[model samples]
Target: MARYKAPTTRLRRLALQLRQLREETGLSHQQVANETGLVASTLFRLETAKTKPQLRTLRTLCDLYRTSPERREELEALLRAASEETWLQPTAEYLPGPYAAYIGFEREASALHNFEPSFVPGLLQTEAYARAVIAGSAPKASPEEVDGRVAARLKRQELLTQQEPLTLDAVIDEAVLHRLVGGKAAMRTQVEYLREASRRPNIRLQVIPYETGAHPGMHGSFAILRFEEAQDVVYIESSTNDLFLESQEDIGRYSLMFTDLQELALGPEATDALLAKVLEED
Candidate 1:
C-alpha cells in the first residue's frame, strides 16, 4: 500500500483542532469510539492524520465532541479543501509520504524562510548542482527517476518568479559554499547561480560564516513557510523522514531559531561580497 501523506494546510489545521477538542473533553480514543460507534483505531488514525476522514465522519466527530458552530463550519471547509488535488501531483509517484507533505506546503506558502547548514536549499540549486546531489545521494535511482525529480524541483523554482512570487529568505552556512557538492566547476556555477538569485527582489540571501559557532539552528535545518490565511508551518527534514509542526508553540520556537540564525548571518551586501570571494577561489 502507498503510504498516506499528511493532509495540506486546511486539513492539518482541522486535524489539530480535532485532537485539541478530544483532549479538552478528556476523551480517550476508545471512549470517543464508544460514543461515536467507530473503532478506536479508526479514531486514532483520524486524529493522528494517518488517514483522511470523510466529510460525514468528520461532521459526526465534531457533533459528538460538541464543537462550536463556528469551528464546525471551519472544519467542513477543510473537508472541502481536502477533496481538491494539490499542485504537487506530478511528483507524487516518486515522493514518499513526508515529501509529499512538503510539496503540498510549498505550493501554498506565500513566503519561505529556510536555513541550510550543509548544502544549498532545493529552491536555489542549479540544475547541475541538483543532479549531482541527487546522483550522489541516491545511487540506486534510475536515470528516469532522477530526471523526474530534477524537473519537479526546477518547476518548483517557478514559484519564485510567478506573478505573486513567494518571498524567499534563504540563509546558508558558509560551509555549504565551500563543501564542493559537485566538484570545482559545478561548485563555481552553483555559487554564481546563488549570486544571481540573490539579485532578485523577492529573494534575500545571507550566509553564516563558519566562525559563528554553536548556534540554535546547529542541530538541523528547517524551513518556516507562511501562508496568507493558514497558520505558518515548520518543516524539519531528517535522513529518512520529514516532520511538519503546526502548533503555535512549536512554530513560535522555530521562528525564534530562524530569527537568531538571521541575526548571526551576514547582511546581503556582505554575503554577496563573500560569495564573490569564494567564486574567485574556484
Candidate 2:
C-alpha cells in the first residue's frame, strides 16, 4: 500500500515527524507539553501513534518547532492524509478492535510479507473457507455478525485486484495444510484456492516442511507490510490480541525472521507442487 491510502501510517508518519522536529530543537516531550499546555501523555501518544493529533495541536507544535514553510506544508498534508476517509470506516462496527487500524495500513501496503503457521492468511482464503473458519472461531457470533465479518474479510481481498495491486509474499507452515478448519471439503477448496492464488504475478507462496522444526515463526503468525512512503510495520496476532509494531528495532527483527523462513521453506515452484500434492491427498 502507498501512503496516500494508508492513513494509519500517515498518523504514524506525522507522529514521527513531529517527534523528530521537537528533537531537532532539543525540546523534550515534557517541555513541549508544558509549553503547549497539552498533557504530557497527549504528546507521548501522538508521538507513539497511539492517538491522532488534532489540527490545532499539530499547528501548535509546528509553531513551537519553528518549521520552515515547505516543511510545515508537508506536515499539513500528512495531517490531512491522516484524517482522510479510510477504507476501514465503512465496516468500522463489525471489525475486531485493532483490526481496523491494521486493515487501514494493509489497504495501502505496496507489498506484504505474511507468515501463517496455522491457517491460510485471510487475503488468500476462499469465501466458504473464510466462513467456516470464522464460524469456528466465533462460535457465539450471531449469524448476521458472522456474515458481516465474512463480508469484511472478502472485501479486504479487493486490495489484490485494486488499480495498484498489493504484492503478497506468504510463508505457511506445513501444519496449516494438515489442520482441517472447515471440514474436509472446505479445507480441500481452501488448498485449491491457495494453489491458484500463488500463481498470480504479485503473489509468492512458500511452505515450511515439518522437518524444518523449531523456527522463529513457530511463536506465532505475523505479517510485515511495506508502503511506498511510510516505514514498514509488523503485525503480530494471537487468539486474543493483535499488535502492530513500527519501531526500527521491531521491524528489523521480524524482517530477518521472515527472510530466514523464506530461505528454509520450499521455493515457489516446490510450494505449488506441495499444494498440488496436498490437494491430491485430501
Candidate 3:
C-alpha cells in the first residue's frame, strides 16, 4: 500500500548522507534553503531521494555543509555511481518510474525471489508471451511503447546469463499454468520454456497449488531483491501505483512471506511434473 517515487540504492545512500550532513549543521530545511537560495521542497526531495541530484546542487550543498575533504570525496563517488547510465536508460520514457526502478534493482541484485499469482514472471517470460502481456495490460499503449516494454522485459532476462548470474527463485500460483496469455500454441511454448529454464542451476521454479487454499500470497504478487553491497528491498507492483519497501520491518515481513510461499508451493520435482501436465493439457 505504501507508494513513492523510487530511487536506486546509491542514490538512497547519497540522500541519507546529505540528510546527515544537514543534521550535523543544525540547520532546518527552511534554514538550509535560505542559505542556499533553493526552495525548501527541493531540498526535502533531495534528502528523501525523490529526485536526482544534479552536480551543481550537490556542490552547493557540499559547500553549505563545509564538508570535509574525505567525506566530500565519498559523496562525489556515490554521485557518479548513482548517475551512471544503465541499460534501461534508453527505454525509461516507456516505463513507469517505479517499474524502471524495479528493473534497476534487478540488474544490481545478487539474488531475487518473486511470487506471481497471475502470469509468468517477467524474467522467465518468452518474447511472444511478454508482448501479449504488455498489450493486454495496457490497452492504451502505442505499438512502439509495447515494443519498447517487451524489449526491456527480455533485456531483464540477461541477468540470469550475465557473469555471476542472478540467482532467481520464483514461486508462481498454480492458476497461472492454466491461464492462457498469448494463445494455445504460445502458452505451450511458454510452459515448455519454463520447464527448460528450471533445469538451470541458477533458476528455481515452483508452483502454489489451489489445494493450499488461501495463503499469504493472496494479498498480491511481490518480489524480494537482495544485494551483496546494498540492503535488501521488497518490490510490490499494482495497477495504479508501485511500492519500494526498504525498511527493515518491511523487508523482514516480505522475506518471511516469500519463504512461506516457497513452502506452500511445490518442490522442484513436483513443479516439473506439474509443468509437464500443464503442457499436456495445452
lDDT of each: 0.85, 0.87, 0.90
For 1-115, candidate 2 gives per-residue lDDT tens digits of 1122334777878888988998999999899978999999889999888788888888999999999999999989988888888765555666676676688889878999999
What are the clashing pairs of model 3?
Answer: none
lDDT of 3 at 248: 100
Residues 67-152 of candidate 3 have per-residue lDDT tens digits of 99999889989999887778876677788878988988888889999999998999999999999999999999999889888988
Off by over 4 Å in 1: 1-6, 17-35, 61-74, 246-249
Best-to-worst order by lDDT is 3, 2, 1
Query: In model 3, where is the ten-residue run with the lowest total lDDT?
Result: 1-10
Best by TM-score: 2
Candidate 1 lDDT over 1-282, as tens digits, reads 253343677766667778888999999999998889989998877876667788889988888889899988988888788768766666666666777778778877899999999889999999999999887888888887688678778888989999999899998899899887878999999999999999999999999998898787778899999988677889998878788888999999989888889999999999999999998878
- List per-candidate RMSD values in Å: 3.3, 3.7, 3.6
Which stretches in model 2 have alpha-carbon errors above 4 Å? Answer: 1-7
| TM-score for all models, in order of appearance | 0.82, 0.90, 0.87
Which pairs clash in model 2? Answer: 1-108, 1-109, 1-110, 2-108
